[model samples]
Target: MVELLDNQRTFHIQVKHTSLVLHVLPTGHVTVIYWGKRLESKSLAYVIQDIGRASYISDTDGIKDFKLEQLPQAMPTHGNSDLRTPALVLEYADGSRITNLRYKDFKVYSGKERLPGMPTITSGEEVETVEILLEDYLQQVTVKLIFSAFYEYNAITQSVVVTNLSKSNVTIEKVVSSNIDFLDAAYDVCYLSGAWGRETHRQVRPLSQGAFLLDSKRGASGHGQNPFLALADKQANENSGSIYSMNMVYSGNFQAIAEVDMHQNTRMQMGINPFDFAWQLVPQESFYTPETVLIYSDQGYNQLSAIYHRFYRECLMKSSHAEKVRPVLINNWEATYFDFDKRKLLSLAKEAADCGIELFVLDDGWFGKRSDTTTSLGDWQPNHQKLGGSLSGLIEEIGQLGLQFGLWVEPEMVSPDSELYRAHPDWIIQVAGRDPQLARHQYVLDLANPAVQNYLITELSTLLEKENIAYIKWDMNRNITDSGSSYLAVAQQKELSHRYILGLYHVLEILTEQFPEVLFESCAGGGGRYDPGMLYYMPQTWTSDDTDAIERLPIQSGTSLIYPPISMGCHVSAVPNHQVGRITSMDTRGIVAMQGNLGYELDLTQLSTEEKLLVKEQVVQYKEIREIVQLGQLIRLTEIENQNQYAWLYRSKDATAFVVSFVQVLARANTVPKRLKLAGLDAKAYYQVGERICTGSELMSIGLKLDKPIEDYAGQRWLVKKIEK
Candidate 1:
């Protein structure tokens, strides 16, 4: 037997019959190994614990028939159940001895760059040893992980659950979170508990160089495996970027979702921090905490605690007076491309308002010298050739149709030919000798420059002041290139990232405070800049540019796991999805978009009356239950990974709710339940929404069981709203 080195001083746990060593490495890798024939994998023994016993229910639509046989057998009733379990769970092959001695067989490595030499930073100290204090949670089964010195691995991990059983009072404080890297696992998901899911806010204690860890979405081919997450840090990242992640999980119910938008935690890491109850352990007592993280095949924040709470409590959770309705918005990129004008916009706005839209957003072309990617980004002035009048006048006209006006701006970018760029040629993030590469007609602005930041702030403020815009679609089109800046010295260039983000934060802070009511939605070329940082200022994020309904099922599905639908900007675009060229049915598009902060991104003026009426009806329906869809408990009724069959659910605390199930429908089989084993129903009660009443047992067992034709759409849903108390 070989004894492993406890060099990091991370942990020393002693059980009655075993000893465990937990340590972290310089590469930001953590190692947790048990000394005996480890009994890994969750067991039914913990059934007395919350996870094994927590009840589940749903009200979101689309689940009629589903089989439990396809899911993993683990009893993950509470916490983030979908995160990948470690390979450490696999013990020895033989069942011989319980272990008199021990053998070490674990090695997890993060990406390491063999730089010419280690970096010298004037900022702080070089890490020496990781410190961990372990106290067996009274031996019955609890371990408290008391750690100092936040490491890199902390950000990349979400699957850590430590049992606390110490006899004396012990408080674990988060001093620092590390930048750890992991090898992509087949499956990984970081389920944020409570406030952790979105609107990430880490008040003061920031895991530097970090973002909220939403669950990982693995590509389809590898069987729900998140290939990106499986990646250990690549050697290439050694010189510059530093990535940090935090596992902010809270305990108990309603802990998996956010209660509000922009509602911040004491910590302000995009307000994406998780919620939790303190584990007040007594003598021999134990508390179990499950954190959200991803290591699975595929899966997948804002700030202001008040705004966040308002969003949830006011907009999403309010079941009374027809959910106050965030205006149904329409963006024009999917509608007109580069071929629209004032007349075209007004026409679309008219159609949209008739169909119940409250806001119309003109994307990309109205400002600067832009027509296509070849020119004009920094000139914030209106493109007079394209605009018939002053921006404010056009905005007022759009508003006259009973809709709010919105516009797009990429303040952190500039076109070389733009007026702003010509005047401030030194503002771009580039070396004097290097020719900056452009993406979508723009070069990145050096926000790190204090002067540039002030200029952006002034221009942004002026533009808003002059316009009647109610919303701003703030966009960042590209990543940093050349990694060098004239504004930053050699040492300062390394500081660019953190400083750049700080600069962004400064710019948004000024604008948001100055214009408290204007809603700003962050768009990073669809998704490139999606991190909790941006969400702090802008509660919502435009998920991706590809808006096809069929394509969105997976995207929306994965996004829903970590972010509330309200924060995911899903829109119904023109039938020939400009991105994919596939024409999805309008109803199908509406249904998918309705699942999120619903809107239109299509040329509505072209729709037939029948389709227009359908859209009108959808708007009415969304207004009616947007609260239920946004605030209620979310559950996956169907297997998310199975493409042929899709299912999900949401519900209020009451027994009444709905489910949405999707299936192409093939040959039938009785082996699979035709209906749901609908959960969270009180076995003792009877529920009646109409003359017909359902016993809890019936709903729990058969769930209004029915068998309909495979292609039957309406047959897939079983809406059961409760009447009986």
Candidate 2:
């Protein structure tokens, strides 16, 4: 519920257990008064009166009583006499760079609104929205600060829309999505940072006096940093204290900053990276920033994650397969790579069907003149030489074998040796005089060009129309370099990265809308572009190229902080794992991979008869409880940081079924059994675990004692069903 205190000039937005309070100062500036647990009282006049202090005294004569530097502003702008970071920066055609925005008006609505050309939370009866308008009189620019409150999820969504209102054109250098100021700086910042194989590793540090920024300047979201940032109280932990997190719903170059001012006030802002970005805004033309999610949790980090998981699954992810049970498929990437023929694929499919697999994914080398990764990327035609027949013929054969067919394509890349690149070299992103750089033997396609985007849409649509494909593994294997587009003017070269991403989103939106039946899983050389923006189009993403189960423990755990399991595409690779060369048990592999969109990535024909039987059993077991794993509430029981054990629990929405997965990284000679207390269960209910019955209270308190593993890298999965009173 949103309440406006007319007498006090304070607006309170309360959703579930959280409340955000803002007060409009006498000078028409909005200042954030409080954000955290809901307040019991209504009046915030005391908060406004207490703002005057010696530390906040401004040098100006007329405004000595009201200081912009001391005020906890909702959105700070430049040329406003504030020394802290500005949320909006604009340049006028008359060579003026000053910008000052003040409150103009506001509109409170009943339902939520979707962000244009971006992913955002869906609204229903349980959601309320408010749009506050601010205007820069000097520059004739108007900014709209939009906030959507989801009562059920206890979350708020924020974004900004800047429109050029004057007859003259204006240039926007920086426009952040959301800016929030806190009265104190007693917090620690947490973010995810890592590389390709080991993506989304968690890191935390104290919020010092200066600025702490996490950003991705690459064309994609990149592997070095994720678009998520969180601030927690200094005493916060997994189960207690206040935690606030912000996740940018953008896929391209983005920035998140946590700045502490001289008065020890904390200001957090996130949006598009302004390093090389400049938007030309003509009269009446507007720029919309992507939505940023704000979640406040007083319970701890786990509670914070649970809220995000629920929101992403129910609202952000709109793919038809988002709520459906994903098929237990087998990918041939590691098994055959680029050396698979029609006969070889059929053989693998036959073996896979025998092992109860539901789908067959023919990864790479199926299209173009492609025999290897060095050629034929942009060309999407099936190679009759490699397949020994037409693509439709092979797909029909696979369908006759009682399995669905999937194909992999890297549409955003082109090989210099291929026909597509040879025909249109200008379609690749390159500077006028500099030579184009290549990664993975490919050049990044110039998606910012409308002709290039239209060509891709046409080629991909034709293929989908002609074939009976059920799934698509869309991969981008290289990061952009020589980031200049041929079609854009020299003055607009700096807009290449953001424009490229926008173009890509347009293509994805059209394709996904047209082919609603086909499930598209995104991959950027594995996990490089795994962010909420991609999840808005595809249901899941290949978590990483590193498939080692042990290495995946930390990777998956860290990713779960912001994304749900349904959004992670995990596969059980072969023993002596191809990525890390660590030989973990098949049981452990299956257990770890089962935590996500479960599948296999090994050569089934090479396994022994006994191993094949085990594979069949594992597939059947996963099918029996895939819903619980996909749609359940995930409770992280233990982390793999300093311990040799990692564990988690999944509780069904109805609270009747649950699954617990415990993995032992290393074993000791004579170690005692460990006890794990489960979460998200009805305390008064009785649950049947295996053949034993235990009350939820007993399970959560006394906990379940786990026996020591007989060997290293062993794991166990426990299934529990609730019983009637």
Candidate 3:
């Protein structure tokens, strides 16, 4: 609920267990007085006091004792007495960059307000919001800081809308979605950072006096740095201590930063990466920044992650398959990389159907005479000659075999050897005089162009309308380079990156709404575009292209830091593992893949009789626990840093069952077995695991024992069902 104490000039935005109190100073600057545990509606003006003109800190508004530099400001501005990082900076036509905004007005609303052209929390309509308006009268600019509090999700969404009310054009040099200040800097910083094939590795360090930046300037939310950041107490862990986290609902270039000022206070900000980014606002035009989800939990990282997981599952995702049990499918990427004929795919699909798989995904090379990745990206039409039939004919054949059909298409990219690019070379993002750089032998489509958007909609709609496609692996295999749009004017060239993301969101919005029942799983090579923004359109993402079970432990574990397990699309692939060449047992691979939405990605026809039987049994096992594994509350049973053994627990929504998955990456000889402690079980309930019956208390305390004399890259999973009286 959002409460405004007008008499005391304070606004309190409260979720279920958290509260953010904002107080308007006598000089009209809104400052955050408190933002931690929930507090009642009262005058919090006394919570903040100035340092009274310390060295290098000057007075403001003729108030000797109060200075903007020392206060925990709500909307800090540039070129002001506040010497720390400003949340906003506007450049005017006269080359002036100073913007001092004062509180002008405010509004309280019942339901959450949606950002005009962005992917955000829209599923939850019962959220409360308080929008505080600040204006710089000199520049005729108004900034609205919007805060939406989600009661059930225990989270808040923050976004900014900057409007240019002046007659002249204004340039927004920097504007973040949210800026929060903490009175103390005694916290540790945590973020997800890694490279391609190894995305979302958790990194943590103590927050010192300087600034720490987690950003993605790779045009995509690069695999190098994900758009998630958290501040935890010095002694924080999975189950204890205070934690505050933020994730941007955006897939473009973004920045999440924490700056420690000289006063030992920490300032946290998240939004579009200001580096090489600028947006021009014409008169009467408003620029809406993307939304950022903020969550605070005193129960540490697990609680913080639970808030994000539930919020994303309930509020962010819009696909009809969001809450359903995902189909167990096999993608033909690794099975037949660009070298499959109609007969080859039919054989594979036949074997998959015999193995009880529910879906058959025909990956690349089925379109546009595409024998290799160097050609035929933008051409969505199927190569009927190569398929020996029409696209629908092939799909109908697969469907007759008791499996749904899925297709892979890299629609956002254009191969230079394709017919589409030949007709419209200007459709690619490129500067007028500079040669466009290519990644993976393809150029990114100029998504910012309305012409391009309409063409994609028309082509994709035509194909999807004609064929009974159940799922689409929408992949963008390369990051954007030579970032310039032909449709945009020279002055707006800097807006191409964000504009591309907005355009992508628009196309996805229409297509997903049009085909609500069709499951859409996004992939950017694998996991590079795995941000909350994509999850809004596509229910899940291909977790990583690296399908090795042992290598996936840290990747999936770190990704689950902010994303739910259900949103990860994990698949069991061929042995010698393909990516890392680490040969693991088929049972271990199946158990690891079951941690998320289960699938297979290898040549099923090549599996031996025994291996094929194992695959069938794995399918049966996954179907039995699919719902609980997808919708359950996930808790990290062990730290992601534990290289020897890693474990996690999932409790059913009704708390009637629990599943724990553990993997031993490398077994040590003559070592004692380790015990895995579980969490979030009904303390009084008794659960039956196979033949063993144990109370929840015993499960949480004495724990489950690991298999002794463990083999290399071994894994195990147990389903504990409550024993009713």
Candidate 4:
């Protein structure tokens, strides 16, 4: 609900258990009065604070106790007596950067409105939006701060729209999507950081009296730094204390920053990276920033994550199958890398079908003259000779084996040695007179070009239209290096990073809509571009190329901090694992992979008879709990920081069924069995697990004991069903 007190000039936006209050002072400066647990009282004017200014502190317009630096502003401008970081920075045609913005007007709406040409939350009846317009009357610039409150999820989506209302052009140096200031710096900052093979490792540190940054300048949302930033009370745990988080709904070069002022007040902001970024807003032109999700929870990290999970599933994802069960398939990437014939794939598909797998994904090497990662990325045509017949014929044979077909394609990359690049060398992103750098023997396609967008949409649509393709593994194995675009002018060159993302989203929007039944799983060399923006187009993403079960413990846990299990594509690969070279038990691998959208990435035909039987049994078990696991409320049982053991629980929407995944990373000798406490269970009801009956209260408080033989990389899964009266 959004309430505006006309007499007090205060706006209160409430969602579920949270409330965000803003007040416009007599001087027309808007400030955040309060943001935290909901306030049920009708009067909120008393919440606004004016801590008298210090001796040397600068005040605004000679008004005593009215300093901009000390106030929590809604949108602060630079060089206006505010020494803090500004959310919006603009340079006018006169080369002047100073401007003072004051509250102009506001509008309260019933539903969330989409940001033009940007990925954002879907509009729904349960959501309310408020737009606050602030204008620099001197410079004739307008800034619209949009806030959408998701009523059921306790999430508020924020974005900014900047317009050049002046007669001359305005160059935007930095435009942050969202910013919030806290009264005290008494929290630990948590962010996800890692490299390619070990992506999304949770990192936590206490917020000090300086600026901290988490950024991605790799063109993609890079594997090194994910776009999630959080602040939790120093003593906060899984089930208690306050936690505030912000996640960007963008998959591009981005920045998330936390700054502590001299007064010990912490400010958090997130948006597209201002580094090497400058957007020229012509007269009457407007630029829209991507959405940033802001959530607050005094109930702890679990509650904060739950809000993001539910919000993404319902509001961000545009796929028709967002809430549906994803297919339990087997991707052939690890099984056959770049070497597979029609007969070879058929044999594998036959074995997979016999093992009860529902889908057979033919990964890489099936297109162009591509035998390896070095060639034929943009050439989407099926290698008819290598496949022994038409692509549709091979798919038909695989379908005859009782499995659906999925294909792998890298639409955003072009191999230098391929037909596509040879015919149009300028299609790649490169600057004139500069040698283009290559990664994985390929160049990033110039997606900012209209011709490139049309070509990808046409090629991908043709393939999807040809056969019974049930899924697509969209892969981008390389990050962009030569960031210049041949189609864009030199003045607009810096806009390439954001424009390319817009182009990618444009193509995905069309293709996914045309093939709504086909599930699209995005991959950027594995978890590189895994942000809410990609989830807006594809329902799931390949969690990581590192499929080693033991190595995945922290990766999956950190990813679950903001994303749901249904959004992670996890698979059991061959042992010794292709990436880590660590041999783990098949049971352990299956249990780890089953925590997400389960799949197999190993050669099924090569498994021994005993191993094949184990795969079959695992497939059957996954099917029994697939719906509950995919559509459930995930409650992380243990923090991944523990390193030794990490566990999580998934409770069904109705709370009648629960699926728990517990993994022990390292084996300890002569140690007692560990007891794990669970969450999201009905305390009054009894749950039955393999003939053992216990009340939910007993299971949660007393905990479940892991008495099995403990070994390195050992994992376990349990399903608890409610006992109906």
Give lDDT tens digits, candidate 4, residues 324-360.
9988998888898888898889999999999999999
Number of clashes recorded per candidate: 89, 0, 0, 0
Whole-model Cα lDDT per candidate? Answer: 0.48, 0.88, 0.89, 0.89
* Candidate 4 minimal-lDDT segment of 10 residues: 47-56
Tens-place lDDT per residue, model 3, 59-170, is: 5678665667778888898998898999998999999999988889999988876788888796544688888999999999999989998887789999999999999999
lDDT of 2 by residue, 451-492 (tens): 989999999999999999999999988888888889898778
Task: Please say which candidate is ahead in lDDT: 1 or 2.
Answer: 2
Where does candidate 4 stray beyond 4 Å? 6-8, 708-710
Q: For residues 1-725, could you state the per-residue lDDT of candidate 1 as single tens digits?
A: 11234442233322222233344432222334222211222222221121211123221123322211111211111112212211111011232211111112232322221111111111021111222322222232222222221122111122222333333433221111211222112112222111111221111112222233332211000111111211212221211121212322211111111111121111111111122112223444332322222111111111111122222333222122112335688888877888888899898889888888888898988876678866778778888779778787788889899999888887887887778878888888777787877766677887778998898888889988988888899976665665556797653454454355557767877887788668888776564444333444566778767786666666666555444555678888876777777766665576677666888887888888888898898788777666656555555555433555445555654536653434332335444546655655567777653366887778677765544543322224344566555
Clashing pairs in 4: none
Model 3 lDDT-worst window of ten: 49-58
1 against 3, candidate with superior TM-score: 3
C-alpha-based local distance difference test score of model 3:
0.89
Residue 570 lDDT in candidate 2: 90
What is the lDDT for 361 in model 4? 92
**Candidate 1 versus the native: TM-score?**
0.60
